[model samples]
Target: MKLRQKILLLAVAPLAVAMLGIALAVRFQATQLAQHERALVEAAYLQSKETELRHYVELAQSAIAPLVRSGRTDAATRQAAMEALARLDYGPDGYFFLYDLHGRNLMHPRQPELVGQDLWTLRDPQGALTIQQLIAAAKGGGGAVRYLWRKPSSQQLAPKLGYVVAVPEWGWMVGTGIYLDDVESTLRQLDARAETDIRQTMAWIGVIAGISILLVAASGLALNVSEHREADAKLRQLAQRVVQSQEEERARLSRELHDGISQLLVSVKLVLETATNRLRLAPAEGAAVAPVLGMALNRLDTVFNEVRRVARNLRPALLDDLGLYAALQHLAREMQGGSGLEIAVTQSGTPRELPDEQATALFRIAQEALTNVERHAGARRVVVALAFDADATRLTVRDDGHGFDVARMQEDPQRGIGLRNLRERIAALCGQFDIVSGMGGTQLVASLPLARPAAIAHDPVSAGPSPS
Candidate 1:
């Protein structure tokens, strides 16, 4: 994996996990909230049903009280009472029953067959007394019981809220109940909604995970490509440097052979000429040999001057003996002689000596710049300026030439080497380099930190010759 992929994964993995965790938490919270809301609704429904049932029982009790108190509680009166109770429809799935204080059923709305049956003898499959408990409570005081009730015939379980009231004058108890199965239907619907929400949240999590992985992969690929390009550029720069070093070495050797060996040969020729002239006047045939020696001498002088010029061109001794300014002046003068181009050099502020590496780097940059100007620029005027300000040494070279496009040159790898090298050299010195070129002219500017040389005893002679 590339570094970008690693970094992106490092950044995104935690977030993805956190998002999933949050999604799960949110889903759980939503489910809880939905359940809570459903519970509240069910509670409300049950409360409303309880109120309606209580009102219905009160109405029945008030209607039957006058007949029972007047001692008209015969079979016809009881039948009228049952008819009156049946007319008040409490709701569907509701039941009404009347029982005596002895726990015997007096009347039941749906099951008249058990009218005289003792309810205290009734037992559910769980072996629990059913009607006897409610009769005892009603005989003591009116109360209600909310419990699971089962139908004797079908034995189906259903939730019930039962209310029992005592009628001591009639020796009877009254009770009513309603089934709770309808409320459970609403809960089932709520559960279905919660399940659907969970599924949707999981789908969103999957989508987020997929997008995060794709982004990480793309970022990694991009980083790998960028690193490869940088490595290639560094390799090309190294190769260029190798080629330049080889050429420089060759130039140095050529200069050394011509300046050292050629000069010695010319001196030997001069000595030979003096000997030939003296022998001609002596008793020897030196006159004929003297002309040949003269011709040799003339040839030797030409060769010596050529050799000295070539050596100086390769690496000027004045650069080492004198300083950077003097060397530049000499270079400008020599270039002016050969190219017939107008060149000027200017300096200002204190002229302090620089380290050997710094001086050499600056000189080489200037040399390359001038050479490029000669080959590419078709102008007659050039200016090289050096100045010192505060702790910085600045150099500027400007040429009034038909300058090429700077942007294009920078993009062209083939033509950009010189500028790149110059930038690298300045960067190595913790300096800055900038170039500005257009159709009108071009300018190269560099600024280096003015590092003071080590303190040494000043010698007047050591200062060397000044610029002419």
Candidate 2:
């Protein structure tokens, strides 16, 4: 993948995973929260229903209290209370029921025929012995029981919440009940509302996560664009500089040939013409012409040597003929000859052949460093070292000249291009290059790995005071 795509992937992959995790966590939490809230609301609703049923039952108790308040000590009072309860009624589906101590129906206000019938083993829809449980509650000092029964108005089996009381003055059980389907309906409605709220909350979270992801992706794309533009600008500038340098080199070569080699060739031609004319005019003058021929030969030899020097500067023929080591030694010798500088060469480890591109890169780097030492370093002594190892090769060039600030030069392209080019060539070969410089001297070191044909190896060079 391209760098931009890789960067975007790195940025987005984590965010996507985080969003998914958050979404799942929120959904689970919301469901739990809704369920908890529903339970609380249901309790509150059922409590209110219980309060209403109790109030209604108390009203029924008030109606029968005067007849059976224990102060009335007559069988006639008991008969009057029983008849009154059987006849008394309230709103539709609201009534009191009575059972004797023997688990048999005494009076059912709504269903008159059920009076006096045995009801002990009667079961609700869920297989609970409804009449037996209710009789137990009434006999054991009165309580409530939940069961299913046929609601009077609806004539349908529905859940009922009932309260009961035992009258000790007579063998009677008194109870009142209310249908509970309304409470269940209210609970279902609440559950639906909670689900809707949770879903809405989830949707909003999804939208917010989407927006955040979009923002991050946009920022990454913008950064990638900015970096690409900067790289393109640098490449354009380097291309222009390279074109200009090539033109200047061509011009210099042209001038050298025209001024030196061209002039000598013209001189040789004129001398040959004169010798030819003299030889034809007089055979006796042949010995005198030998001097002219010899002079012409010397001039041609000088021109040939000058051409060779220029060619060597362009591309050393020895580099192709004898490999990188010989070429570097020869360079040091030539530099020392011209500048009167003492140059040292050190060799280490086994000599191994390298691929052509690697050999060329090392030679060029050495050539540039030596040129810098000759033109810019003003040094009295220089050292060149080449090491070959089982895994890699290393080259270092050092000079004992007063050094310049390496940082300042790096920021100035015009001043640093030669070094930049050298560094770039090393990088292309996957090799590392470093330069350390100070008042004492400057050092250039480069290393290359043998295993990876396209990679560079780095060997750190220890720098110390220049040789005395």
Candidate 3:
């Protein structure tokens, strides 16, 4: 993958995983909590139903209390108590029932057809003896039994909670029950609502995650674009600088030829013309013409020297013939004589032949730094140090001059052209260039790596004062 795509993936993958993990954790916690809530709610609802059923059973017993307390075991008293219970009810499906010890239905206000019938063997759809369980609950000093029975209102067999009590005086069982379908319906609604809320929460999380990922992607894209634009600008600026440097060099050469060599050639040409005229006029007096020819020969020599100087400036022959050290030494000597400043060349480590490009780049970097020192840095002494190692070649130029602000100069195109050229030269060779300047002085170091080197012992070298 491309570097940008990889970076985007790195930025987004972890976030997506974390968001999904958060969603899963939330769902897990919410599901567990919902289940717990359902259990608590169902328990609370059942407890309330039990309480209401108990109250209803107690009210029925209270109504029949007169007969039992008066010691009346007659059929008419029992019939009157049953009729009173049959009339006492809270709703359409709420009523009392009666059964004797033998499980014979005595009174059932809701199911009148079941009255006076033996229903001991009767079972609900789940194969539970409904009457037997109710009778057993009554025998156990009034308790509740869960069984299936037909709901009086719907005529559908459903789960019911029956609270029963025994009237020992008449050897009869009496009970009432509340069907559980409505409780289930209410809990189902709660479950559905909870599910909806959970789904909504998940959706929100998904949306937020999507937005966050998109934002990260957008930010990365913006950053890449900004960096790309900056790189392009820098590239264009470097190209311009290269062209400018070439033009400046060409202009300098043109001036040298016009003002130095061209003038000398003109003098030589004039002296030759004068000498030719004298020789033509007095062919027999050749000794007199020798002086004119000598003058012309001297001018011709000066013009040749000027040509050599310009050619040396173009490409120093020492760089290809002798190596970087010799070229640097020659440059130092030339700069010292021209600038009338103290310049020194120092060498350390094992000096070895370098690649042509690396040698040229290092030389140019030193040349520019020295030029800068000569023109801008008003210093008395300058040190140019070259070091070699198994891994790389290093060049250092230091001048004890009042230094200018490095950042300020680098930002100013006119002031920074030389520095930028030096930097580009090193960069083209896949090297590093650094400059440090302060009131102490300016130091420029350029490091270029050799492609490969033979195994050789490295020397511990340091830069110090130049030899007087």
Candidate 4:
């Protein structure tokens, strides 16, 4: 994978996990909240049921109070009590019952056959006998019982809330009950909705995770492509340097052959001519040929000196011997001699010695700038300055010449090559180069950081003469 993709994945993976965690937490909290809401609703319904039961119980107690106080066992009063009980209709999943002091059922909304049937033989869902317990409580004062109830014909079960009260005059127990299945049904629906919400949240999280992953991958690919292009550019620059180096080497060799061997041949010719004239003139005639031979010898000496000078200019031995400053001074003097132009060379700040590569680079920049001045500038004076401070070494070459527009020259491939090569040389050393040229003159400035000996030792080739 590309670096961008890797970075994107690194960035997104944590976010995905975080989002998923948040979604789970939210779902859990939502489920809890829904459960709480359902509980509240069920409680409200139960409270309403309790209210209804309380009303019925109060009315039934009031109706039976007068009859029980009259101490009447007459059939008319007993019929009126039964009619009053019938008037209180039982709600769905609800029933009302009355029990005598002996725990025999006097009236029941459901299972009316059990009325007046038995004494204290009923057991609740947990097998706890409840009728005798309620009768004992009734005898003491008034009380209630709440437990699960099951009809004999049905398998369905439900929680039941019941309240019981005693009629002391009649020695009877009255109560009402309500099943809790409807409340439970409401809770189940809430649970279902919670599950649905959790699933939806998880789905959204998955989608975000997928998109984040894709974006990371794309960024990685883009970074990889950018790295490739940078590598290619560096390779091209290296190739150009190799070609330029080869050309410089060839020029140096040509200068050496022409200056050294050719000078020797010319000297030999002068000596031969002197010998020939001496043989022809003998003792007396030799004096006449002496002037011609002297002139020839002088010409040969001139040719030899010119050849050596050209060779030195091609590849200066002084560069390695005396260092960059002296080499530049020598070049400036030579340019002044040949071009008849005033060239000024100046040094400022501290004169600390530089590594060979740095010195060579500065010298070459000076050489190329002067060469441009000699070729293109129709000016009379040129100034070359070299300054060194603690941080960096700076070189500037300026000429008062007939300068061309920099933009127009850069647009042409042939004219632009020299400036481009100068830039590349500076860049390789992690330096900066700038050119400013106008109608009157052109100036080239280059600045390079001073490298320590350790850095120079690592790459002697880069520390060599500037490629231009």
Candidate closer to the true structure by lDDT (higher is better), 3 or 4: 3
Model 2, 227-345: lDDT tens per residue? 88877866776788689879988999999999999999999999999999998999787899999999999999999999999999898877666666777778888988988989987
* lDDT (C-alpha, whole model) for all candidates: 0.75, 0.82, 0.86, 0.74
lDDT tens digits, residue span 1-468, model 1: 966667777876886788788778878887888788888988888888778777767877887877777788687987777676656555445667888888788777666688878777776556666788778768777766666676444558866777778888777788787776666776788778777877787788778877876776677668768877976886677687769867887877766666765665766677676676677677477665667677677767776776777777667666677866777788889898999888898877767666666666677777878888988998789998877667877888899998988788867766777787788899998999999988789999988887655632243332234334
> Candidate 4's error at 258, in angstroms?
5.0
Question: Native-vs-model 3 lDDT?
Answer: 0.86
RMSD from true fold, candidate 4: 8.2
Candidates in order, TM-scores: namely: 0.56, 0.78, 0.74, 0.57
* TM-score leaderboard ranking: 2, 3, 4, 1
Q: Rank the candidates by lDDT, best first.
A: 3, 2, 1, 4
Give the deviation of candidate 3 from the true structure as CA RMSD. 5.6
Cα lDDT, model 3, residue 139: 91
Q: Per model, state how many residue pairs clash.
A: 0, 3, 0, 4
Candidate number of the best lDDT:
3
Cα misplacement distance, residue 360 of candidate 2 (Å): 1.3
Model 4 agreement with the true structure over 55-100: per-residue lDDT tens digits:
7778777877788778897778876776677567655545567888
- lDDT-superior candidate, 1 or 2: 2
lDDT of 2 at 44: 81
Give me the runs in candidate 3 sitting further than 4 Å from their true place.
1-33, 60-89, 95-152, 155-175, 199-236, 271-301, 350-353, 389-392, 409-417, 424-429, 449-468
Candidate 3, residues 9-126, lDDT tens digits: the string is: 9999999999999999999988888889999999998888888888899999999999889998988998899999999987888888999988999999989999999999998887
- Evaluated at residue 119, the lDDT of candidate 2 is 85
